[model samples]
Target: VLRGQRPDARVIEAVRGVTFDVAVGESVGVIGPNGSGKTSLLQATTGLLPLAGGQVLVRSIPAFLGVQA
Candidate 1:
């Protein structure tokens, strides 16, 4: 969903119409060029970003930034 050069939600869609599934004990990487919403997607998926578009389900408790569980 590479809409534009910059990560702009208003001007263009960063991660548009994207979805996927992962099994237990699996690892995935969100790789892309700069301003490609890599971090945005990760944060959104981890319940760090505000509820602007979709939903995020956390099966287990997450370890947030600067905090320990």
Candidate 2:
């Protein structure tokens, strides 16, 4: 590979076909085995990761999805 040349990228579908809703004051949890994209789902929802397809609706003006040190 040439210097400074970007390598070919592979696309892996971490999360797909997932849909859910939390009512006002409702709560939920995501549980899955390792490599099952649990973190991917949350990241996508929180704007950390971009979604190939799908959308997230946040009622709060600013959603605190993660804590920054």
Candidate 3:
């Protein structure tokens, strides 16, 4: 999720600016090749990363596949 790093890096624009939403009873899947910004997107949505140009919001618990939840 930490893209390019800099001593004073304050802006963090996620690759491609991918964003989406799901309803109370809706389901969605995120499919992409390796290193396709999937993890980054999850992290950003989970408030683990900061948005550079936009915003991300999550209203439920997130269960990460590999990393600690």
Instruction: For candidate 1, write residues 1-69 as lDDT tens digits.
Output: 222344554543557666677688999987889988887677656545543555555454433332211
Model 3 misplaced regions, further than 4 Å: 1-14, 57-69
lDDT of 1: 0.57
Per-prediction TM-score to the true structure, in the order listed? 0.59, 0.67, 0.57
Better of 1 and 2 by lDDT: 2
Better of 2 and 3 by TM-score: 2
By summed lDDT, the worst window of 10 consecutive residues in model 2 runs over 1-10
- When summed lDDT is taken over every stretch of 10 residues in candidate 3, the lowest stretch is 60-69
- The 10-residue segment of model 1 with minimum total lDDT is 60-69
- Name the top TM-score candidate: 2
lDDT over C-alpha atoms for residue 38 of model 3: 76
How do the candidates rank by TM-score, highest first?
2, 1, 3
Candidate 3: TM-score? 0.57
Q: For candidate 3, write residues 1-69 as lDDT tens digits.
A: 444457676544446657576888998787889867777777766656554545554554443333332
Off by over 4 Å in 1: 1-12, 58-69
